[model samples]
Target: MGWRRSGHFASLTEDEEKKERPKVASDWTLAKWIMKYLFKDFRSLAIITLVLVGLGSVLALASPKIMQVIIDDVFNTEFIKSIDERFNLLLIMTLILLSVAIITAVISIFRTVLLYKIGYNTVKKIRTDTFTHLQKLSLKFFDTQESGRLISKVTNDCDKINELMSGGIITSLIDFLTLIGISIMLLVMNWQLALWCFLFSIPPTLLISYFFKRRARKAYRKTRKTIANVTANLSESISGVKVSKSFTREKRNIQEFRTVNQENREANMKAVAVFATTFPLFNFIASAVVGFVYFYGGWTLIFGSTAILKAVTIGEAIAFTQYVSNFFRPILNLTMFYNTFQSTMAATERVYDLNHSTSDVVEKTDAYILPEIKGHVKFEDIVFGYKENELVLSKFNLEVSPGEAIAIVGPTGSGKTTIVNLLGRFYEILEGNILIDDHNIQDVTLNSLHSQMGIVLQDPYLFSGTIAENIVYNQKDVPFDDIQVAADSVNAHEFIERMSKGYDTEVGERGSKLSLGQRQLISFARALLPNPKILILDEATSSVDPYTELLIKKALDKLLSGRTSFIIAHRLSTVRNADRIIVIKDGAIIEEGTNEDLLAKKGEYYRLYQLQFKDQENGSNGH
Candidate 1:
């Protein structure tokens, strides 16, 4: 079993395989989409945050200028004649600066809280929209997708977008405005100092930014891809752990994990290398600019009365140095913000594509609801294939009267399951039509069609919940008595009652707590609970033991009473009583009739019965 299962869990692709769908051309579109969610959904919070940012910037700019006043005006003996008046002026300026600092701190606190609310609210909407859109997509979209990658999209990628919404873009915008405000203040006080500082500092800042932008973008994108890959590998490994242990493949599994983990480490190291170099370089440039300001300002102040150098006050000199520091602060902040922006852009690209990806199967805008049906079905010259240029079923046709029971038998890959799938309209037929009760399936709403049908696959899936919950899934407001009745009908009530908690016993993930037969019984109970007009059991009894299957066989008549049914099974004994036995080969029906009639004909159906059913009869007679 382990060797057989190995191929299913083979190494997965690191990226989602590309398809023919259109790609997003630019990161700007994703940015705008995120902003739209932030502002449109929670406009009040967004507006309030912006206003606080603007007010905080104003106070930030004012506090530094007030320092200049305190130095030049409050303490100047020439400006104020009396000592008491100068002291009084000093007290007032001190109080005003204190008030500005206090107000700025208060605003900062409120702005931080608002940003959190905005970030969470925006992300909630994005996650919800992504999930809702995914639900609308056809099964074909999911058939080729890796489950781990999809989980990564919903969890990790959305988290990156949340980071951007909370603190990345909004604060960076405020920082830019603060940078501009500092520049203007410096120029107003002294243009020569401001011009000289810009010449030395601005060029290097721009040069560094230009040099790292592309590298950081590529590095961060690789990191995002690698992380998704790691997540996918982890998910697959956990799912296949049983098989791996069975085959003693622990060492091999560990080695495979190490390979993926190492790739992730390398990608992160590349991004971190860029991050490590950027801020220090910016900090060095800032320190040099600040030093130059102090040096030049000191020379001007010391060389007063000289024709070549302008006189500068001590107060102006101190303020000029502070302003230069403020100017570089935003630049450094921008450098840091850009790194985060690059990662967010990578995440946004995957999320945006997922959100916008169109479903290959779509219902018409004007498609009407399918009224309660009588279960008459028709497949008129159907043609389809799971992949391009391949045909699983071609020029195939079948008509089932209301309440007829059909048993489809064929060799593997002979399109037995595809015939039933077409009846349910799970896949679109390439060149034909499926009609239920004279209503074209494509013309009817999917919900109305699916609501009246019940399907039980070969592998029964039960969610993690109490047995009662699993049995009553998707059918709201069902009475406990009704649940017991459905379970009893399928012979599940006896075992369920034997458990400590009876119907309330937890089934664990995918019903792992129960035996395979028990899970199949629960699935049968679930399917029957709906009392659907059409019932499909595709190898539904394959997992049940002979004893449990015998119990199910006894109740088959009651389960199929007054409902049209299609049964696809490998065991010849299961379909001996169907209203019509259709023997298919190479996607075409080669024999069709009652069991006795087909046996008399000695055709494909007779041959299958002789090969499969004769052995079962002989073993039973011998016993």
Candidate 2:
């Protein structure tokens, strides 16, 4: 069988579908999106960190002074005979350095806790917002996109943001702040050496900073893209494994997956190349500065009184040099972070675009409810097209009265489902208005309108839970007695009782534990549970066995009584008893009448009924 990729996605309005994506507010920068959106109460976390980090900085700066005092005071030539003085100074320096480490760790702990809050909360909001927007999006949008890609956006891509928020951003900033404090201390002790560092390291530091960020970003982008492809391939193969096995297409699928997997590997290797390069470059710069200091400072000491420049104190000089090396190291880390930042931004853009996508059908601000809708639906001179100068539906008109049963019969591409979709307010008409009880449907709140309707699709999906839970999906607060009554009405209660665990049994994934027919009956029961005024059955019985169809037919009669219904079906016999059967072809109404009326006319509907049901009848009788 050939598969076509056509979906409602392609039929989106040219203007609405392609509107420029909405953007995050200009004031909503990276920090604000993290702090404000994720953790509104960041003040406490921020203040605690500030206090501990401030203490850490002060203690660290005080340590070398203690070192200088011990060397010049307690260990001086005059005090050398006093062992007590030496011991006291040694104890003081130990406590000072130890205090710095303790304060630093305390601050680190608080920061880590805060970072997790930022990550966890942001992900929660992001997922919620993603789902909220997802629900708002018209069915057409999802039709064209790959489900796996959507899943990745929510799962893997969001995870990258979480990782960055948890540690990447916070640690990078903290390290940067620490580097600043150390540099200032070194400058206070020796401006000449500090000046050397600032001047000599400028060129190479900037070069590596720019190079590593850009190259690493390129690698990560490729990696993310490759991973998405791999995800899509996996979802496709796994979801359709039965078809693949039956058709013997395993080798082809494997070959395709391998190609994507290799691309992901190569992309990561390229990223590693840049990642590995940063360390060597960092070492070379630090080492070169060490040589510069030794050679330059030694010449000054030999030729002049370099103590005026503090160029000969062993501990102080060592500290100054250590500060210089330590200061420049963070730039390498910052560069790598920049790469992760870029990948994160790209993922954010995709998500933001989805959230911002304009709805194809926007409700009017002054719109009112279609009051007391008698279920009289009319498509008056309707015209629609996704693209300019091309129309899928043109000049279409149909009318149905209150509580009327209409069966729409058509071939594969006859636009049978489209009519149902429009009636349910899933899409907007391009030219004409769709009046429900003489009120335009576009004027009504979607939720208010949809609540009155129940739709059961060909493939009914049940969440992983008890059968009772699935039946009460729409109204959880409903009493158990009501649920049993609905199930009993649809003849589903008998089967539920037959199960080993009754309604409490887990349906497993997608209701896999039950036979397809049983699942359909359960879906029917669920839809009818709320007693919706409107019902739509689009191939609802197509996957069920004939015996189950018979049971469903009986249940449907009881459930559909006195309700407006549109049955989109290929099984003509199911709708043979409908009050009015309409035949549609190429987006136009070809014929319409009562069942006896259409069959008597001997037109499209008659021919279709003959072609499909004739074989079933012949097989039954062995004719």
Candidate 3:
């Protein structure tokens, strides 16, 4: 039986074989996205940036100009006093330096605040838009994506962009302005010296930067991959702790976890090592530039000073060196910025992929919204599969009238739950259609179609909230009296009232504190409280004890009286009173009729009942 079950599990459905969506390209470029994404706010950001850059350039240029004055005229009052009555040199220097500092500080503050506002506000809007887009994605998209991966996109990927916004934009802007300022200052002092420095510097900066980026980008990719793997593994391990303990596989599990942990550490360290290597090299180049500048400028001022007319002074040379050194920092950052650009683009593609999926299953624009319904259902040549090569249900047919109960009994893999999934539109039917009240289901709005129906699943789900809250989830404005009435009708009120807080008692996550019987009752109350026109109880009473089953049967009679219901049950008694019994085998209805009619025919249903009774008899000592 176990081997057979394993074989059955290997089979995939036609729907599953639908082409998997392509992953976002790893080498995606951020340039196009940056242009498009920021274009809407470009005018404002550009105006602010230009204003800031102009201010920064003025400050950079002024630094050396002020120093030249301080060294020559402003500080050299003794030299100038012989010619004329001197103004207070110290007081003049103080005012000039103080004014420059004030302007620079103001510009820096304005740039910082505006950059932060643009970046953070853009990311916030992007996150909100992405999340809202997800809500519109058909279930098929989520079915293929791992929950952890989806969560990573929403959180980790968004977080990366947030960091980039906070510092990356401002750094780039300042670096660009500094580069411009440095170029203008160096040229004015000595064009020959500036040209030499610029030419000699490009090769090492470009070559080392290229290699460093290649290595760092590769390492970063590995780090991202490892993080995703670790998250997926951790989620699975924690979620299946029961299976781990039951099999006593804790040692093996922990060992496996250690392997993933070690790999993650290695990946992260590799990325860090690459970043560390490049930063030092970049610093070395800047130092070498300083050394060259000092060597030539010092010599030029002393001996070579005579070659040029009124050769550059000590303060002018000092200012040129400051420009040379300060300029390289932004150059280094802009050169390495490509690495972050690539990463951000890749994340964007992924987020967009999830947001813009065109669902294979979609209602037409002309689709109507289903209103209050009588629940007449028809499956006209309905067909489906989990994968392309494997068909689960083929050319199936069934008709159920309003307010009538029907049971679908089938062997495992005979498309029992698949049928239910199709009806719920969780998966699209490959061929044909399902109709309710002569209106095709595919031609109705999903929200309206689903609203008219209620489902109590085999493993019923109750979120972490009070029982009353869960029951009245969709109908929040419903009075507590109505909630109690619904609970009492389902016989859930008795056990619920036993709790200290009654309906207000917390269910814990997924109602873990409740007994199977108790959960089933609560599920019933939750389903019926909506007063849906159609109800599906898939293995509804299978979790209950005999006494609980009897109580549920009474409640079931009341609930099923006016609504069309589908009951998929294993117990023979549960289906005995169904208006019609559908005995299914190998994805086809092998036999189906009323209970007495099927018994008279001595067919599949009868044989199944006989087997259950025999098993019962054998269990009781010596029947």
Q: Judged by lDDT, which candidate is best?
A: 1
Ranking by lDDT: 1, 3, 2
CA deviation > 4 Å runs, candidate 2: 1-69, 72-94, 218-236, 247-274, 291-297, 305-312, 363-374, 386-389, 613-623
Top TM-score prediction, candidate number: 1
Per-residue alpha-carbon lDDT of candidate 1 for residues 1-623, written as tens digits (9 for 90 to 100): 12212432211211221231234736567767887997789988899999999989878898768888888887665674577777777899899999998999999999999988898888889999999999888877888787767888898889888889887989888898899889899888877777888989989987787556656766776887798688778877899999989999989988988998999999999999987887788888888998887788678767653543455576777787787878877887776686686567667788998899888778889999999999998989988898988998888989999899999988989999888877777777898888899999999988888888988888989999999999989889999999999999888899999999999999999999998889999999999997889999998887678877887888889888888999888887888999998988888888899889999999888887788766776774111
TM-score of 1: 0.90
lDDT of 3 by residue, 20-82 (tens): 224443223343454455656555785676678677766866766677666766456556463
User: Candidate 1: lDDT of 150?
Assistant: 88
Q: Go through the candidates in order and give each one's C-alpha lDDT.
A: 0.83, 0.75, 0.76
Give one digit per residue, the lDDT tens place, for model 2 in 1-623: 01012322223322331343243532135445556654464566555655655555455556565566566665566655578767877788778778767876776677677668767777778878888888887776776677767887887777877877775766676567767787788678777777777788867887777666556656766887798788879988999999999999999999999999999999989878877887898888988887776765686667754534446454555566666677666777766675566556556656655666667877688866555556777888888765557776898898888788899888887788888888787877788878777777888888767877788889988988999999998685988888889889878899999999998989998898999888988898888887887889998987788877888888777877878899988878888888899999989999999889988999998898777777786774111
In model 3, which range of ten residues has the least summed lDDT?
A: 9-18
Q: Assess every candidate by TM-score.
A: 0.90, 0.85, 0.85
Order the candidates by TM-score, highest first.
1, 3, 2
Clashing pairs in 1: none
Candidate 2: C-alpha lDDT: 0.75
Judge candidate 1 against the unseen true structure and give its global Cα lDDT, from 0 to 1.
0.83
Flag regions of model 1 displaced more than 4 Å: 1-22, 78-85, 210-233, 252-277, 304-310, 614-623
